[model samples]
Target: MAQHEDMQEIKKRRDAVLSALVDGVPYHRFLGIGFDRRGDELTGVLNFEQKLIGNPFLPAIHGGVTAAFLEVTSIITLSWNYLWQDMEAGAIDLGALEAGTLPRLPKTIDFTVDYLRSGRPRDAYARAEVIRSGRRYASVRVEAWQDHRDKLFAQATGHFLMPPPVTEAKAGKPG
Candidate 1:
């Protein structure tokens, strides 16, 4: 059925995005971020390690690392969402995204991170949501958790400059 084919295509796109994200970004791999397909959304996980600890005394993960993880997760989520729009509009070649051409990708406009608790040395996970997406800009919210979603280690919200399929953003139309 057409619905099944569409779902398959979406899964393929997500896989491509995940590949390009985890493999393409060395830092992300260094952070040990893992991707999970939870029904529809992507979940990011970072297993705890000593090197990630900024305060060995507390054996806590670095605040900077947590911030970086949130930022990277948000960016990847936004990029993946944009992939569908770009492919649908035929605005850019799929290979551009697949090739890991991050040089031309969206840049952070503003980022605000809130450290809810000290990140202990353990496995860390993150969830990102695109709060809003315009043609040229997007706003995202991210949360980093160790054990459970309700117990968050950090939360971040930011805006990014989207590149492709942004023709109408500058003209003030919805993306």
Candidate 2:
């Protein structure tokens, strides 16, 4: 079925995007967050390790690190959603999109993070859902949880403005 092929394409794209985003971050570098794509949802896991430590007393993972994980995962999920749209519309080449080369980060018009619990110094998981996907904007909700625990450490909602296609910009460039 065509839908099966589309799912394969999406998985490939998600892997590429995840690798690109996790490359330069220090915490993500050490914590080793793993990206898994399931249809429209993305789930990332971070294992507790020395690098995530803030203080030995509480051994709490830094809040900033938690936020970063949530943000990046959410953005990538949003990007994947957009890619799916492109595929459905038959508007762009999937190969170019997979090369870390197409569409840029959409401007983040609004974001709100709510802390539900403290970041544990152990395993943590983040899952995101796309609330709305429009031509130029998307809304996503992300939740971070301590591994093997039902409590959430943090939850965030992000609104991003998808940028115009790179090809469109090139077409407008002065010759």
Candidate 3:
């Protein structure tokens, strides 16, 4: 029973993170991106719109849009990893995360995107994998796919400077 309750708490935490991802970031919402999360895994989804097409002749998704999608995936994945540690340590204020007030997202140091193929004008998906996450820095690799996972349209690697860990004081809670 205790294990089940722990699982419930974890799910609640994850859901709050997801909410912050969707509601806290205006650009993410503007781009119509959503995420599919399973445990620590996250896959970004970009629902297609006519505005996403850059070239009407080819009707391909915009290059800028693809890069933004990949970057957002990387940042959110890294932020989630960082916050999960705080949650496990019992140092995180769930209310702060829920409010997205902590602004705990890592800052991008550099990001490089490789366009493998022109993105088809349709819904696209992306998944980010963490290469390394340390105390102050993190690296992530992300791939975007349109129809199939194996057939990637674009991929990117990013380095970020992580934010300071959230403590009770930082979260505006009594320490």
State each model's CA lDDT, in order.
0.79, 0.71, 0.85
RMSD (CA, Å), each prediction? 4.6, 4.0, 2.7
Q: What's model 1's lDDT at 93?
A: 45
lDDT of 2 by residue, 100-168 (tens): 455565567877889887787787888888898787788889988875446788999999888666466
TM-score of 3: 0.87
Q: Please identify model 1 stretches exceeding 4 Å from their true place.
A: 1-10, 86-103, 166-175
Candidate 1: residue 175 lDDT (0-100): 35
Q: Which of 1 and 3 is the better model by TM-score?
A: 3
TM-scores for the candidates: 0.79, 0.72, 0.87
Pairs of residues clashing in candidate 2: none
Model 1, residue 73: distance off in Å is 0.9
